[model samples]
Target: MGIIRKTFYTTVLTGASVFGYLGSTTTLISPLPQDDPFWRSRSFARYNVHHNACTQDICVKRIPLDKIRPELLQKEGDLVLEFCRGVWGGLGYKPQRAYLARKYQGPATASQLWTSEQLSKSTYERGTQITDHFEVVEKTPTDIVVRCGDTPRNPNPRDSDGLFVISAEVDKQRNEAVLALKSCFFNSGRKVEGIQGPTPGWMEEAHRWYTRLWMATGAWRVTR
Candidate 1:
């Protein structure tokens, strides 16, 4: 009787395990279903994007994300708003939400005020355009200057708010975070660390890639 009971328990356990495995596999291994609306819709379909999108990539040549935006991580080539999140309250962005949505989602249209600034984020990202490229210049060991976008000249530049060199410095660095900024005047009393690793999976992968980017090219932009 005891042997039979043990055998029955083992059989039940195995069956449960098999079912559990299959259930988990559906979410992880199963392809986007053919029946799913997106797969067949044709208008739009996308695979999972990295959840934690970074505008700042960390690299050997660059500073860490938390160092720049203590509370958030940014990507390598995102627009000004996302990248500036490393700044205090990120100072938000010069443009409104609708503007950012347009920029981030598809073809970006700049405000009339944005004309004086670099036209494309790529220009700033690759250090291609001399107007907004600052990573190459080192204003000081601590204070780095932005390139020639809008330097204290224009009351309101085309693409940005100010027309001068926005400055920043390494207020502090720790395992919790690496803190720095594009403008020191704004960061009078800010937290040096708050960024934390995202959850596992795409979220984590996104952060890792972001880290890779900044680790490579993040630097202080100085004036010539």
Candidate 2:
């Protein structure tokens, strides 16, 4: 009877957890659309070569600009920047930063290392290195692309030096803006016989969940 009661409670908790995750505003797209500009880009093609095992996904949220408060609409660029800033400000990105800080004995807060103006400038510039090993590789008015881990900039990336591409785009159509956070990871040395070229299933699942949480929180921050 005790075992039965425990099993019942576990099932209920699991179901509730799943329900809560599904209730978030974020949605995920896997194997990103083939014809999309991002997928067709030379940079993407380079990272997705035969020697690399790549995994790609996108988390998306839509916001109706008309519904936003007047005070938040002071400047269009500010809103875009706020959304970008909010992405890094969320729980998903914080733990890694905190961990790195503890490991390196460095300042944990962005304020300690960079002023607001400097951070913003670096965030938008190509070739600029940001926190968490992310480097800005591409930028446009509505989009920014960052490469993390072993980037293409390295002439010879190690087999263990996997690479990740993280991008944020705000696509405006009519009165709504679609916010997308696209992520792609490349496991180096796919051709090696015994190489672990693909991301593990469990890690991929965890990444998707965290990304959803991040997108939802970022959207809430920008919209609020």
Please report how far candidate 1 places residue 8 from its true position, in Å: 54
Among these predictions, the greatest lDDT belongs to 2
Candidate 2: tens digits of C-alpha lDDT, residues 130-195:
553566666665566666655334635445443333333344555666777777776544454443
Pick the TM-score winner: 2
Over 4 Å off, model 1: 1-108, 112-168, 171-200, 220-224
> Model 2 reaches what TM-score against the true structure?
0.70
RMSD to true structure for each model, in Å: 21.4, 5.4
Superposition error at 167 for model 1 (Å): 11
